[model samples]
Target: MKNSNTSDNKDMEMKYVMVIETSDYLHRLEANQLNLFTQKLHNGISKLLKKFDSQILKQDDNTYIVLFDSVTNAILCALKVKSNFKYITLKFDKSIRHLKIGIAHHTNRIAAQTLSTRMCEVVKNQIVITSEVKKAYEKENRNTFINKEHIRTLNFSEEQFLTNLMNCVETIWNNSDFSIVDFSKPLKYSKSQVYRKMISLTGKPPSSFIRDFRLNRAMHLMYDRKGNITEIAQQTGFKNPSYFSKCFKDKFGVTPKTYSKQHAN
Candidate 1:
């Protein structure tokens, strides 16, 4: 146990690991083969991180934004191509071992050393966030999937995964207030099927996806309108301010109050 802990610590120190999985992609594949592609990607990342004895953090669904940082490993992970917008099945695989992450936090240096593993790279040549993630998801219009973001660059396999997962992200994004009973009735799929689909696409259950989506949407709402945190919470489907605050901090790395202070103009 001591050796295992030591090894884990070493992995955490030297390497930066990030894993994002989607269930909608899994839905498109056979039941027995859910997340195999993502598993391979995760395996590759784990292996790479192990070489550096890096620490790993896995975030499910469309929550990759939370893993952004300026370290070389973080920057390399951010550049990983998981899917494409136009093509749903072409996988573009690249080794991020040599990628150098550059951040503006320090003009004297190229990246942020203080944030060790929390930041991802800032690539001038890359457009990481796109409307395509939203559009591809809207096209599906299901209860279990939701559109999150579209990959600017992807190969065939990656495209396939994005097409399916983006749809799942959209499904969840549009129906943040939908109840489990409603989902079970309309889809006519078993509860397990519903759970598995969400798990495969978002690396989280359906409920967590909805909650995070609501929080993200609430953040947008709070940013755009004149309202208090309580109002934003209710508007985003939270019945209680306390729970909403907890979820907000868990997802965004800060309380709603802090987020408002940081972003409010």
Candidate 2:
């Protein structure tokens, strides 16, 4: 791979692209807080980029586009960022709580950008490298990249199914009375079919998927300071605050109340 500092170069040289997207939780912060949060995040990530000899190509709002000359450097930097993300967030008064990072390699910048965007949409709170990057990394290292879970290559139909399922879940996410039957109705699939497909695509059953969606929604609401824990729980379809806290803690390692307090202004 060759590095070109100028975009006008017509020569084809392989480059690794990394996309970093902060969670929507950051949107809830006030302007000054958001600026501080961005600064902290940028500083933390800048150190990683320097360590890996990469450079930031662009940054817009909560998203950053980074460039790496080597696949090995890109993979190592991404893994480091993913592992240290929580600690980086803790540096901010109003933390940017989650991230979705995608890495891809291609000779063309636009193609790499598209692949990275797709990978970001499919994964959450983690780093996902395209199969191309994964192949290059393993080949160059002469060893398997042990974190197979971080590599995802989704086909068109699987992507479409995930999009449809997410839309369906969004439509009825707040309905505490929502059931598997209700969930399957809008997807135009039989309950059994939906269950099997959900497991196949997401490695989670329908009920677990629904619960995770609700918990994620609850976290967004908490960051938005939309309501108290009880109101937020009920709004996200949890029948009670205690159960909501239990589930939230189980997934996030922190109760909703504690999370809210930690991110409070």
Candidate 3:
């Protein structure tokens, strides 16, 4: 939030994390079991965090949020355990619901936009925790398990900078192909603008961020044995393997084949 040029490698400490109920559906579980369910979530999250190198802070309650040092590690955790959550009804004595999680580690304005934006799901209203909540918790010095004042606050100007920057990152991340021209056109900004925004939000330029995101997805798919390179390339928005390979090598310093071989083996 200060934008004070903090160390890029600065470790993630205990930061405020809040979970909001995003769905309109009732929790349905009995009061006694609700406590147990939250415990599962708390413990499940703790166990998941151990798989990554980052740190996590959880409290005695059913809710928990962690500050992760690496976005990559965070993403992996989010993806890996998202499907493992099961909510049960005490009366029914069966699992009846699940959860969708929203997470943010910084208190910049960009973090606010991420929470306020409506999710893509057409029918359901989305619920999210905002960066303002982080500020509020910090002001009260009551972040629970999260360390007090772990994150710095930002002013209006700094907030706007973060918001614009995160928008660019999301734009590139959502786009299937790393088509710089098309995505940049939406902002009516120059390629440099998009590039700078990407750097500010994700510590990388547009092409680089998109490449890494795609590669991460590709790895998951390859691990699942879901598709071959040609198919995966197309699915990820690369028109052909040659173009994908070139971009991949430029980022990873190796051809996809070699990279996959090294990682897979």
In terms of TM-score, the best-performing candidate is 2
lDDT of 3 by residue, 1-265 (tens): 6665453334324333323231211222334555576666667666777876544433444333455544445445655455445433233322335344444545442442244331111102122233454444445554442222222233344345545544564556545644777647766678888667556544666666566667655545654457777887777667778988887666445666765554453
* Segments of candidate 2 deviating more than 4 angstroms: 1-41, 47-100, 103-126, 129-150
Candidate 2 lDDT over 90-128, as tens digits, reads 755444466778887767888677667645644443676
Residue 203, candidate 2: alpha-carbon lDDT: 67
lDDT of 2: 0.74
How does candidate 2 fare on TM-score?
0.58
Model 2 worst lDDT run, 10 consecutive residues: 5-14
Each model's total of backbone clashes: 42, 0, 0
Error at 69, model 3, angstroms: 22
Whole-structure CA lDDT of model 1? 0.44
Point out where model 3 deviates above 4 Å: 1-130, 142-178, 242-265
- As for candidate 2, its clashing pairs are none
Sorted on lDDT, best first, the list reads 2, 3, 1
Residues 73-163, candidate 1, lDDT per residue (tens digit)? 3333444433222122345223211122211122212122322111122111222322332233334444533222422323334334334
In model 2, state the lDDT of residue 222.
84
Error of 2 at 136 (Å): 13
TM-score, ranked from best to worst: 2, 3, 1
lDDT of each: 0.44, 0.74, 0.49
Please, what is the TM-score per model? 0.38, 0.58, 0.41
Which scores better on TM-score, 1 or 3? 3
After TM-score superposition, the amount by which residue 127's alpha carbon in candidate 1 deviates from its true location, in angstroms, is: 12
